[model samples]
Each structure stands twice: as C-alpha cells, then as structure tokens.
Target chain A: MIRFDNVTKRYAGGHEGVSEICLEVDAGELVFLTGHSGAGKTTLLKLLALIERPTRGQVLLNGRNVGRLPARAIPEHRRGLGMVFQDHKLLPDRTVFENVSLPLIIAGLGRREIARRVRAALDQVGLLSRESSRPDALSTGEQQRVGIARAVVGRPRLLIADEPTGNLDPDLSLEIMMLFRRLNGVGVTMLIATHDLALVQELGGRRVILEGGRVSGEQD
Target chain B: MRLWLTRHVQNCLAAMGRLVQRPAGSLLTIAVIGIALALPAGLNVLVRNGEVLAGGWESARDFSVYLKPGEELAQAATLAKSLSANSNVDDVEIISAEAALADFQQSGSFEGALTGLDNNPLPHTLVVRPRPEAPASELAELARELGKDTSVDQVRLDTEWVERLNAILEFVRRGIWLAAGLLAIAVVVIVGNTIRLDIENRRAEIEVAKLLGATDAFVRRPFLYTGFWYGLGGGLFALVVVLVGLAVLGGPVARLSALYGASFQLQGLAGSGALTVLGGGLVAGLVGAWFAVSQHLTAIQPKI
Candidate 1:
C-alpha cells in the first residue's frame, strides 16, 4: 500500500532530516514507528502525508509515486489517508459533531449521510453523547477521542497517528492505543510513531525503529 | 468546481459565525470600514448637490437687449414680436422706458429720485427667453446676432453667470474624484491590514487545513468571505452614515437654499451611486482578502 525508495529530505542550512530511507508497508498491516526525538519519524510521516516532498528518490502510495506527482495532485492522494496529531487539533469553535463531519463535508457528502456516518464514528469512540459540545468544553482525553473520531469518520484506508499519546498519562495513552487496536481489528491500516517502548512491546505488532534518520531495527 | 464553491461558501459562513461570536471586534472593524467608505460617499453627495444648485442659478437669467433711445416705439415693438416668433426664443417680453420708470417709482426708496426726470431715462428693453434645448454657446451667438440690429444699443448675454457656475461645478467634480481616490486607497490599505492580522492569528488552523489536502483556494476562501462581510457591512454602515448626515443637515441646507431663492433638493445615494458605494466596499474587502491570502497561504506548511 506504501513504499519509499532511497528517499532523502534535507532542510535548509545543511541539516539532513531524513536520508537514504527505503521501506514499504503491505495492505491492512499495523506498524509501529519508534524513534528518538528529531530522528526523522515526523519527517517520514510528513512525507507520506504529502506535506513535505522528498529531496531525492520517490515516495509511493497505492502504486503511484507521490513525490513525482504534480503539486496539484497531492490533495487527492492525501484524501485516502487519515492523520491524527499529538495535539487534538479540533476546531475550538466547532462542536464535536461538526469537527468529526469535516472530512465527509470536504468530500461533498450529503447532510443525511454526514449525520449518519458522524454518529456512527462518534458511537465507535463512545463520544455519541458529547457531540454537541465544543472542544474547549471537553476534557483533554475526550478531546483526543473526538480527534480520533474525526480521523476515522471518513473511513480512510490508511490511518497515521503521529505521537497521538504524547500528552496523555499512561492510562489514557493505553486507552488511546486500545482505540487504535479496535480500529486496526476492523482492517484499517495503522502506523503509529511513538517513543514508548513499553507500549510497543505490549501491542506486539511489527515495529520499525529509526536511529539518526535511518531505519535501524525492525521486529515482528 | 461546484463542490469546491459549495465548500468555500460553507467555510465563509463558518468564518463569519466565528467573527460574530466576538461581537465587539466585529463592530470595531465594521465601524472602521464604514467610516472610510462614508467619506467618499458623502463628498459625492455634496458634488451632486452643488451641480444642481449651479444648474438652477444658470437657468434664471435670459437674453437682454437695450434699444436705442431715439427708436420709435412701434418699430421696437415690431422687432420684439419678430424675435418672440423666432424658433430659438421661447418668450419675448418688451419693457418700454415708461414702464421701466414706473417700476422704479413704485419702489418708495427710488420714487423721489425718479420724480425729477423730465423724459424717461431708462432705455427700451427686450427680454428673450431661449429654448430649453439651446446650448450656451448658441445662445451667446444669438445675443451677438441681436446686437447687430440698427435699433439695438447693447446686447447683454446671461451666459457669464452660466460659465462661472460651470467652472464652480467642474471644481467640485474634480474635488469629488480626488476625495474618492484618496478614500479608496485608504479603504484598501485598512482592509488589507486587518486581513493580514487575521491570517497571522489563524496561522495554525490554516497550516492544519493545508496539511489535510486543502488547496490554497480552500484555505483562502474563509478569509475572503470574512473580508467580504467586512466590506458589505461597512458599505451598509456608510450608506446609513450618509443618510443620517443628510437628514441632520437637511433643514440647514434647505434654509441656505431658501436664502439664495433656490428650491434646491439634496439628493442621497440613488441608482448607480448606491451601487458604487456597495461595490466599493465589496471590492475593498475582496482585494484586502486577496492580498492577505496570496501573501500568507503559500508560506505556511506542516512542520518541516
């Protein structure tokens, strides 16, 4: 479903963010990306999200080279993938329901379909009752749950969570991981980038660890 | 394209909702824009009103011919009748010297001065009212034509006042254009600066939207709509300001016109001028929004 061939990303001022990385993930596979801070884990996720272009080589998704794709085609490629952030990033002014319905709205879904899908997504995250509440009015955990609901609401084939549990306590982090596991059980491809070694060992999925902008180890 | 427009409109509405959620800030912005727009609009009203007053003043005077004192009354009367029948003249009133002397005697202030006269000192006069469609230069030519007659002493054209009034109107018109130009520039800068501030404040949200595959147009639409509302609301406020100003000063204007013996009407924004005021506001808003969007949208991206 995704592939990278000798992809290199360099920021200005001679800083090498990611270099000579080659990797692939099969369909419906759950993968954990573990790396220390500034080890290019975020860079890899950004490259896959089409937010940053690789300086060299190519990044491919669904058999099309995204790095070689025209800038205009980047959005179309991103629509197929779901992304969650360390910060919930919920629109503070919007109700939880509205935030969750964003992707479907962007997709031009009708009002009825959006309502139905959003309700289902909220139900899956146990946030159906809090749909009318704004993000600021909710607890941090609930807000993160709303973020999760929004990410999955569009039913994207691939879900990327970049440090999704970064700001949460251990119990809350495990709860979010359980939510991810629940999502993965339903055949949604999941890639989680985190530095939590204990959590990774507990989840026991395929792990790819990065060291110094390169993939240093992997274990099933 | 349809989908894009639909979403864009929704995003605009959303932005407006957020703006309204903070009423004080919205009001402040609207007031600023309104004041700027109203300056030009109010000046335009003054220019139009000046033109109307000048037009009325020009319409008052007619062609006057002073006849030679020795000319026979019968001959002078015949000439007046002929001139009255001409296609160019609407009316001709013959004022004989005797009648002119009597009109001077009727006023008690001049009665004693005129009582000592042996023969009527006033010259026989012919007053000519030109056709409504006659041009000013044509009327001057007509006056020159009347001056060549053997029985006529002098032909005084009523055109000098018209020329002077036209000069004043031209001055006011130029002033209006200058004021409008300056005000328009002010509006663009004000709106642009406001939108730029808004873009900076919402930089995070814009970055997130772009990262989610939203296009520049998509991200920019909300801000543009915000600017549009600013313009539209400001325009409406400006219209209100102009009308209120006219209403407050209406009595004074009427009094001033009455003092000058003119039944002048001060016109408010009507027809095309109203459209222009509204359009000006809208254009300012759109342009300001465009500047901010073009400047900020491309520079933001997800974390490096």
Candidate 2:
C-alpha cells in the first residue's frame, strides 16, 4: 500500500537527512522502523504523511506518487492516512472525546457517526469513561492513547506512529504495541518508528533499520 | 451534505465555547476593539450631521442688488423687472427705502435710532432668489452680470458665510476620513496581535490536529470563529457607544437649537453606515485571522 523509490530528503546547509532511501509496505502489513536520533526515520514518516516533499525521489501511496500532489490537495490525500506522535500532542483545551472526534469531523462525518466512532475509539483505548475529561487531566500514557484514538477514529487505511511509546513505562509501551498489533490484525497497515529494539524484537514483525541516513537492514 | 453542516455548526459552537472559557479575557479584548471601532462610528454620525447642515446652503441660491444713494425708485424698479425677466432669477422682491426703514424699525435693537432719524438712509434693494440649487461658479457668474447694471451700485450675494461654512464642513469631512482610516489600521493591528497570541497558546493543539489528518481549514476554523466573535461583539458595542454619546449630547443640541429659533435633529447612522460598520468589523476580524494563519500555521508540522 506504500512505496518509496530512491527517496532523498536533504535539509538546508546541504545536510542529507534521508539519502536515496527505498522501501515498500504491502497491504495490512505491520513494520517497525528502528533508528537512532537523526537517522532519517522521522523524515521517512514525514514523507509518507506528505508533510514534506522528497528532494529527488518518488513517494507513492496506493500506487500514486504523493510527492507530486499539489499543496492544496494535500489535505484530501492525508484523509487516508493516520499519524501519531511522540509528544502525545492531544489538545489540552479539548475534551478527550473532542480530540478523538476531530478526524471524523475533518472527514465531514455526521455528528451521530462522529459520536458513535469517537465512543468506539475511546472504548478501544480504555478511555470511554474519560471522554469528558480534558487532556490536561489525563496522565501521559492516557494522553498518548487519546492521540492514538484520534489517529484511528477516522478509520484510515494506513497508521504511522512516531516514537509512540517514548515517554511511557515498559508496561504501557507493551500495551500500546499490543494495541497496534490488534489494529494490524484488523487490516490496518502499520508503520512504527521507535528506539525500543527489545520490544520490536519481541513482537517479531518485519523490521527496517536506518543508519547514516540510509536503510541498512530489512528482515521479516 | 447534512453531515457537513452539522459538523461545521458543532465546530462553530465549539469555537464559541472555547471563547467563553476565557470570559474575562474575551470581554477585555472586545472592549478594546469596541473603543477603537466606536471612534470611527461616532465620527461618521457627525459627518452625516454636517451634510445636513450644509444642505440648507445648497438651496440658498440668491443675490441682492443694492441701489446707491440718490438712485430713483423708477431705476430700481426697472432693474428689478429686468432681473425678474432673466431665466436664472427665480423670484425678485423689490425693497424700497421706505419699506427697508420699516423693517429696521420692526427690530427692537435699532428702534430708538430709527425714531430719531430725519430721513431713511436705507437704499432700495432688489432681493433676488435664484433658481433651485445654483453652483458657486454659476452664482459668481450671475453676480458679475448683475454688477454690470449701472442702476445697481453693488451685487451682494451674502455667499461669504456660505463659503466659510463649506470650508469648515470640508475640513470636518476630511477629518472624518482620516479618523476612520487610522481606526481601520488600528482595528487590523489589534485583531492581528490577538490572533497571534492565540496561535502561540494553541501551538500544541494545532500540531495534534495536523497529526490527526486535520487540514489547515479544520485547524483554522475555530481561530477564525474566535476572531469573528471578537469583531461582532466589538461592533455591537461600538454601536451602543455611539448611541450613548448621542443621547448624552442630545439635551445640549436641543437647547442650542431652541436658542437659535430653529428646528434641528442630531443625525445618527442610517442603513448603509450601520452596515458598513458591521461589515468592516467582520472584515477586520477575517483579515486578522488571515495574517495569523499564514504566519504561524505553516511553521507547525506533523512530526516524529
């Protein structure tokens, strides 16, 4: 469902962030992208999310070159993809339910559908009882789950999580990973970028490792 | 379609709810903006009143042909007849020296002096009222034509007062425009700065929304609504301020008019002026959001 052909992203001052990185993910497959800081993992996820353009390569999703899509069309393209972040970037001003309902709202879903989907997503994250609670009231792990619920509430074809468990304890990290595994079993293509080698090794999914701005290893 | 409407309505309500969450801050912001908008709105009302005051001058298109001492009544009568025959002259009133003296005596201030006079020194005058609303240039031309008649010693238009009043009105008109222009700039800056602060405070929310597949529009909708409410509240407050000012000044205005023995009403904003104020406020809010969105929204990215 996702492919990259010689994708190169060079930052300003001629710094190569991601150099000629080529990779592919089949439908409903789960992959872990393991890399240290500044190893092009974030850049690859950003490229697939259409947040940044590849400098000298094609990034395709659903067999279409998303790198070539016009800026105005980027929003529509993003509708098919879900993304979660390390910061647990839930809006503190919004209630947990509101944060989760945001993606459905963006997709122009009916209010009844948004409510139904948001309740279901919150239920999945074990946050149904905390729907009316603001993000400020939630713990870090709970906030991150809110972010995850928001990402999946739109029922996107692909889900990308960037350091999804970075701030969590081992137990919470494992639980989050288990949530992703369950989601993948339900046919959502998943790509997780993380520093937790032990967890990825334990899960035994396809692995793509990055080093010096290039994909150094791939294994299944 | 119905779904989209429902979501947008919810979004708008959600936006309004967020604004209400900080009620004190919102009220203070609205007060600041209202003060800015009220100055221009108040000045607009004065400008409209000035127009009405000038409307009388617009219609007072008349000239008086005053005869010299020793000029015979026959000569004044002939001149009056000739002036009345002119197409530009709407009507002429012949004021003989005897009749002029009688008018002077009727005024109490000059009654004692008139009683002691041996003979009336007042000259025979032909009061000429011109056709409806003559331009200044046309009146000047008519005066020149009347001055050429030897039977008349001078043609006194009494337009000097009109000219001075027009100059003052012109100054006030230009002053209103300057005030309105400066206030508009102030409005934009006020709203722009407010929106900038909001963007800063909600930076995390914006990034979160972007990660959740929320487009620029979806993220911007609430901020835009915030600006709009600010403007709407400010505009309504401004209108109230103007009305209150008019009410406070109304007594003095009425008293002055009574002293002058003339009827005058202080004019307030009518249809177009009110609409302009409301629309201008909305536009200012929208433009302010535009500046903030263009500057800050692009800096946020969906990240690792």
Candidate 3:
C-alpha cells in the first residue's frame, strides 16, 4: 500500500517539482500515472522510492512514513519495492542473468534461490533464453524485458515503472502491458507512469493524470 | 550468517577480478607503493647492522690510566693492585714505561722516529677492564675517578668512539623511523588517489547499484577490497625489493666488516618484521579506500 498526503518537492532554485499531492493506492491495485514530460510523474515515483524526500507532507508506504525515514534506512525501505526506468538501467557490462539477479543479490539471497527466481522472472518477461547475453546484444524491447525481469526477480510487493515501454514499438509495448496485466492478476501492486494514453486506456486500469506538478484528474 | 559470508566472499572475488582486469595500471600503482615502503625498510636493515657493529665495540669496555711522567713503576703497580680489588674492576694489568716503549717500537710503523727520543718518555700505565656488564656511563665514571688520583695524569676509556658510534646509530634509527612515517602517509595518499579514480570510473555502476537498493556498505565493499588487494600486492613487492637489495649488499657488507676484523653478516627481515610490513600495507590501503569511498560515494545520488 502507498499513500501520499499533500506531498511537495521543491528544488534549490525554487522550482516546484511536485506540490500538495494527496493520493493512495491500496494493496494489489494496479494504477496508471499519465502526464506530459515535465508533469512531475517521475518526482512522485521518486518520492515513493524514497530517492528524494518530500519537502512538505508525508509519504506513507505500507503505513510507514517514508518521507521521514532516516537516511541510513532509505535502502532498506527501497528494498521492499522494485523500480524500472525508461532507459532500462541494466549494467551494460553484465549479462541478463546478472542484471536480473541484482535485486536478489542486494537482498543477500542464496545462489540457488537467486538462480531459480531469476529464471522464473525472466520466463515471465519472455527473456529467459537471453540470460547469458549482455544488454547491448538485446533489442530495445528485449532490454526492457530484462529490466522488468530484474524488477520482479526479488518479488517486491510493489512495482514502480517510469516509461517501461518508452523505447519499444507498438506491438512490443502491448506485449509488455500484457505482462504487467498478468502480474497484476497475480496480486502484485503497480504504479506505471506513461505518456501513451491509448495504451493506458487499452490496459483499463485506474488512471491518475498530472499537470504542472499537481494531480489534475483521476478516472476509474 | 551464511548469507553474509557468501556476499563478502563474492565481493572479494569480484574486487580481485576487477584488479586483474587492469593489470598494468594496478601493478604500476603497487610498484609506487612498494618503492615508497622499501626506502624505510632498507634503512631499517642498515640501522640494525650498525647496531650489531656498535654492540661488538661496546662489549670490550676497557680503560687505560696513565701515571704522571715522573711516577715510578712501583706506584703504578700499587694503583693497579688497588683498582683490581674494586668490585667494578674486573681485571687490572700494570705496564711499566720500559715495557710500553719496547712494545711500541716493535710494531709501530714510526718505530725509527720514536727510537730517536732522548729517553723513554712513556709513563707507567694501568690497563683496567671493567666488569663485562658495566654500562658506558659507569665506565666513564670510573675513568673520572681514576684521573683524580695523585699518581695518574690522563685516564682514557676506549668507550668514547663506541659512544659516538652509538649516538650516530641512534640518530640514524630516528631518521629511518621519521622517513617511515612520512612514507606511510605517502602510501595512503597514493592508494587514496588510485581508489578515487576507481570510484569515478565505476560511477555509473555505483548509481545503478544504489538505485537497486544496495546500501552504502554493500557498494563500498568491493572498493575496500580493491584497496586491500592493492596494499597486499604492494607489501609483497616491497618485501621482494628489500630482500633483493639486502642480497646484493650482503657479500660486500660482510667483506667490509671482515676488513675491520669483524665477521659481521647482514640479517634479513624476520617473520614478525615481514608481518609488520604486510600489516602496514593493509592498514594504509584500507584507510585510503575508506576515505575515497566516504568522500565520493555520498556525492553520487541516484537521480531516479
């Protein structure tokens, strides 16, 4: 579960990245966040990950105020959620398996279990056969799939994605959305930020739209 | 517990692999550290050998008490007997002026010049050997006490040169230690600069790791291990350099001491000394890595 109460983030030059946002997503819920390039979607997700603290108000994840979490506790708090970025964020030097196993490795999982879960997650993303291949060797779609596998390998309760299919073709984007659908059906909560309104409608999840760093509208 | 061990082991191996990947750069850094460490280590060996030479001289603490020019052999013999009765005086031998003159003429290279003197000008001398364990200060005190006697003109203790040699050796010992300390700081700076460069090179990887929930400790582990390996390699190389230096100088040093009628041999680093060298390397490496990581790691934030 995630909750935001009047959260605001302001940069040093007095530019408000996000301001006074009140929102919530319950357990096992799939939500879509839609906004333009500078609409502060990334900032909201960063707040959830505790990457940047809210300048005002509280961010609660699983009933814990993440905005007030101690600096030392940020990593532990982040470990409970999985994050995927638009750029795929996979270490180019490492193989698909290593990239996927990063989260599990961070959690200090045993080798056998990491291998098993990585295989299962890769299978779900349809990149299981590309485990030993480096990210540079994969297509844009395949690289995104590898990122997804990495996000889910640690079995985090919440999955957050910033433009998960930004670099993919329409067909690949649909395929990736279907993968998220399947994951949502299996009781994994997710918050996805995307500019593709058509895909957002097609996927048929609750949509929260942002405009100029504020929540403009929500559609059920 | 098992998980912690497994992660640390993997971190160490991964760190080693990184160093091996760039062998030339790593070896160059290690060589710099080794040369720095070897300077002091070599000096230490030299100081130890000097101590050995000085120790040999100190063991023979003998003094010569010369009688006044007009003093007779009977007075000198009587003083020798009295000195021999003292607890600190191990032995005393009376050498009359006639015997001293004859002995000097037999072996002295200036024998013809010395034989031209009108009369035997040498005074009766009492050779006093102090107790085996007597300190130099105590022997000087004895010599001073003998000089105050009515029959004695000059009291000479052989310990003066030995004392001066000891002082020089002590000064060298302190200099070596100071050099060692300064070089140790140099080692830390060298290792620190190397680690800082390493952290910069891996900046992207570290950001990604932190984004994926890796703690500062987890991200720090590999770099720290890298520093450790660098230090270890440098320490081993330093030992090799010092040993090789000793090997090259060993024969020459022995022969030089032999010319002085001493069978002195250079001693290499013992087991504990080697451990200390290695330990110093480890500490320097770890400290340098820690400083680099703490300074640079915090500046890099995952900009989501």
Which residue pairs of candidate 2 clash? none
Task: For residues B234-301, write the lDDT of model 2, one tens digit per residue.
Answer: 88878888889999988999899899887888998887877778887878877887778888888887
Which pairs clash in model 3? none
**How do the residues B72-185 of candidate 1 rate in per-residue lDDT, one tens digit apiece?**
778779998898877878988888888888888886788777778777888889888887667777787778888898889999886777677777878877887888778877
Best-fitting candidate, measured by lDDT? 3
lDDT of each: 0.84, 0.84, 0.89
- Shift in Å, residue B10, candidate 3: 2.2
Reference-based TM-score, model 2: 0.87
For each candidate, what TM-score against the reference? 0.87, 0.87, 0.90
Please estimate how well model 2 matches the true structure, expressed as its whole-model Cα lDDT: 0.84
TM-score of 1: 0.87
lDDT of 1: 0.84
- Can you tell me the DockQ of model 2? 0.59
Q: Report clashes for each candidate as comma-separated counts.
A: 0, 0, 0
lDDT of 2 at B212: 59
lDDT of 2 by residue, A1-220 (tens): 8899999999888998899999999999999999898898888999988878899999989889999998778788778888888986777767999888877777877778889999999998889999999989988888888888988988888999889999999888998999999988889999999989998888898999999889999978
Q: Which regions of candidate 1 fall more than 4 Å away from where they truly are?
A: A136-140, B1-13, B69-125, B130-149, B257-262
DockQ of every model listed?
0.43, 0.59, 0.75
